[model samples]
Target: MIFELQNDYIELFKLIKVLDLVDSGGDAKKLVVEGLVKRNGEIELKKRAKIVSGDVIEIAEVRIEVKG
Candidate 1:
């Protein structure tokens, strides 16, 4: 899926929550802390990692592409 960024960037956890990938922000944070989320191709442990355009985030079987 593709997420169109309205600002310069969006927090990783917020992105997940905004996309409805999880039930809430806390769930999204848990996913990140547990190493279930990836930025580009590496495991992203930062719940508030800045997600900007051209970045790809993966969680479970879902792939979200950020676009400016």
Candidate 2:
């Protein structure tokens, strides 16, 4: 999936929500806390990690690319 940025960057959890990966921000947070989210292939635990254009996010069997 591709995510077009509306700002300079987006938070990790917000990105998940924007993509409809989870039902709510709290669900996104829980997923992250469980080490279910990956940033550029590495486990990402920070819910507010700044996701910029060109970054890749992976969750479950889905992959998302952030585009400018």
Candidate 3:
């Protein structure tokens, strides 16, 4: 299902923290450390990796598409 996004493009892992997708930044960090975040169908663990337009981020059953 579509997870409505409030940010068009964000740092790969900051998306998790800023969106409140996780409990806190620490939790978001943990999610990345545990390899739970995916970018464009591949597991991405970089917290500062730039995630630009057309990127797909998935966590559990949530899918967020970055659009300009």
Candidate 4:
């Protein structure tokens, strides 16, 4: 899936929440804390990591490509 950026960036957890990947922000944060989320193929633990255009985020089987 592709997520179009409307600003300079979006927070990792917020992105997951906005995309409806999880039930709530807390769940998204939990996923990140558990190392279940990846940013550019590396496990991302920062829930508030800035996700900019061209960043690729993966969670389980869902892959989201950020586009400018």
5-68 in candidate 2: lDDT tens per residue?
9999999999999888889999999999999999999999999999999999999899999998
Model 4 misplaced stretches (Cα beyond 4 Å): none
Per-residue lDDT of model 1, residues 1-68, tens digit only:
99999999999999999999889999999999999999999999999999999999999899999999
Weakest 10 consecutive residues, lDDT, candidate 1? 19-28
- Each candidate's TM vs. the true structure? 0.98, 0.96, 0.80, 0.98
| Candidate 4: residue 62 Cα off by (Å) | 0.4
Error of 4 at 57 (Å): 0.2
Best by lDDT: 4
Residue 46 lDDT, candidate 3, scale 0-100: 87
Residue 54 in candidate 1, Cα distance off native in Å = 0.3
Clashing pairs in 4: none
**True-structure Cα RMSD, model 4:** 0.4
The residue pairs in collision within model 3 are none
Evaluate model 1: give its TM-score: 0.98
lDDT of 4 by residue, 4-66 (tens): 999999999999999999899999999999999999999999999999999999999999999
The worst-scoring run of ten residues by lDDT in candidate 4 lies at 20-29
Clash count of each predicted structure: 0, 0, 0, 0
lDDT of 3 at 20: 74
Candidate order (lDDT): 4, 1, 2, 3
